[model samples]
Target: MAEENRYTFTVRQATEADWPGVIDALTSAFEHDPVMNNVMGGDGKSQKVRDLFGFQIRHTYGPKGTIDVAVTEEGKILGAALWISPEGQKGGLIDEIRALPEYAKVLGAGLLRAAIVDLKLLAARPKFPHWLLYTIGVHEDARGHSIGSHLLDFRRFQLGELPAYLEASTYRSAKLYAQHGFVELFRFKSGKPVLGMLHPAPVTQVSKNNPAGR
Candidate 1:
């Protein structure tokens, strides 16, 4: 089972023009994700799921935070990662209210349920100045090629000394993150369990001489 990993794809900041590719990769990747299917009321191919991802990417994330996509030299996108700056966290009730219409579009009758699940996940996040690894996914066709790892590597480099927080949608995804230095904080269960993980700042190593590791 083997060949070289594709260094062919280079990660770069995404643009509005990249929406089609980004959405394709995201939807394909999460096609079988139970939590997402439950939220969108169908599989990733459903219009509801596509609409929600589009809303977040094109409207909120692109304008407010950062979205990075991995593209090959020939211009094919293999994956995308969305991040929220510490100052851009939308953990406020006002922000949630603002997104009501959009969430309602995809969630429809399940809006409240989706909101509750989102609140549960949000509440599990650490309250600190850190980047939020909002969402990341690799196209189904590109899985096993290490695209996910490359994306995470770029984020780690971009992060510098700042920590990163994320709620891993599945244990499998959590393991992938663990390889990149994230440790599980807690597992929140609201039907499907999500693992909350954090990649502590490199500064956590400053405890070399200190007895208790901060």
Candidate 2:
């Protein structure tokens, strides 16, 4: 017999009311992420980390991207995923200018480095249209569960023909992404190494009704 599953949760698109939970989960999730620390120092729980998540979640990705959350039956948020839909892939220059003040607040003197990191990632990304997984994080308390996998699959299946792309910050994450059909395109060094991968659009038809393939 297969091992019994202990945790139960569902992944869904995040809404305005879920921003706090989303930020908390992501802050905890990326608390120690190498790429995250490289861009914004301090483990993942600092005010800068919180502020960085707040700015990205509410102002940047939230408006022009898709945000997904994993929640238990009682409605406690376990993890969150931030994404930039292909439609909004190339973020507007206006958006970047508008984001300067907020980025300054979170990054301070390091804002220039953070901007450089963003430019580097942008320049490294594939030229074709694809969904960008900006970041996905799980609350520390919920680490052992398969919440991250669920969050990734939720959007991956619903994406129709669009491929998905993300920079895997660690070897473990890169392997995990590979398990889900993501293949590394290249690796680049910033503060930490980043492995850029792509999950090409599936060859078979992905049902509209059964989006998650459940």
Candidate 3:
């Protein structure tokens, strides 16, 4: 008989000490993106995938922010999500997005503000506070285990019903986002489609039948 594969992992809010692992996973996940290169603009190099993830970790998750992780029982870092909430803020969470260099270069001040208005309009309904899921990734060695979906669910529990948003870098990931209840709100015309998606709550269904392993 074939040996059975048994592995178990869980998701939780990432601590400051988890930043390095998160960065490594993110770098490994996005190291070969032609569209990201174009988005960088100057000579198509903005920051190393690792460095960019590191900077976002430092800038956004510093004092009081949100970053969630999925880790194996044996302590392997599988996936992560870095995000922010605008519950007590005067406006939408897109303000935090505008502070990121990637969004700044692509979206002008007027467009940014206009987007914020749209965000506010959608999230102003009762029981909704906006969140920005800046980045999420699953490590190559741990891809098939539904780790990404678990990480997203963990983030939702951490943030408690806050509407979440993210920019999907690939159609594969966009489909993954959709599987997790993220609906595309916009798409950027570029080397590859960059999809912006939103979800009123985290997705609960996770498929363990797919072939997305590394």
Candidate 4:
């Protein structure tokens, strides 16, 4: 286990090289979400979903939309967070992901569901530029040690001045987001809540205090 004062790791932009590990992490993380099972199918659907997501993210958007990976001293992927800048293009990944043969049918259905929910939510809320928090998953064994919080912190650090957004698939995660200063923007299909947060740009004073620039 990584110690408190010595949680040594590096955060880097994820690459195609990280796809296999990200797939495995996403599978493990979402396996426990009953709604993911209901909508996308269960663990049985994990591989297809993971493959489609990885392909779309790595191939379509490339690094302009960031995927950050946290790796341990031993070079194991501890956790990851995917973010899309509010100023970046939207829905390209959705089209690419929905076009995958293995996932096409369910993907279409899921989007249709999202469309209805998105419309309803939009009707009640003011539109804001958002940094879409597509996914965040940590290895199961790493839970309860602030790994999740650390991952979010790392992503916020990377974002600098960007605002963050996410749709939480579980109530527990909504609470977690609340704890981290995210505001509930709206509730969507299946009771999932969309959250909005912002990360302030790093202060020059703070960076000046560090021996090395972070």
Q: Count the backbone clashes (under 3 Å) in each candidate.
A: 0, 1, 0, 0
Question: Whose TM-score is higher: candidate 3's or candidate 4's?
Answer: 4
For model 3, residues 1-214, the per-residue Cα lDDT tens digits are: 1111355766777777878888878767666654444434323232455655676577656444677787667666677877767743434356456665664544334344435433543443334457877677787776677777777766666545457777777888899889877898776644143677888654322323333532
The best-first sequence of candidates by lDDT reads: 2, 1, 3, 4
Q: For candidate 4, give the lDDT.
A: 0.61
TM-score of each: 0.88, 0.88, 0.66, 0.70
In the order shown, the candidates' Cα RMSDs to the true structure are 3.6, 4.8, 9.3, 6.1
| TM-score of candidate 2 to 2 decimals | 0.88
Residue pairs clashing in model 3 are: none
CA error at residue 197 for candidate 3, angstroms: 1.2
Per-residue lDDT of 10 in model 3: 68
Clashes by residue pair, model 1: none
Least well predicted 10-residue stretch by lDDT in candidate 3: 202-211
**What is the lDDT, from 0 to 100, of the residue 147 in candidate 2?**
82
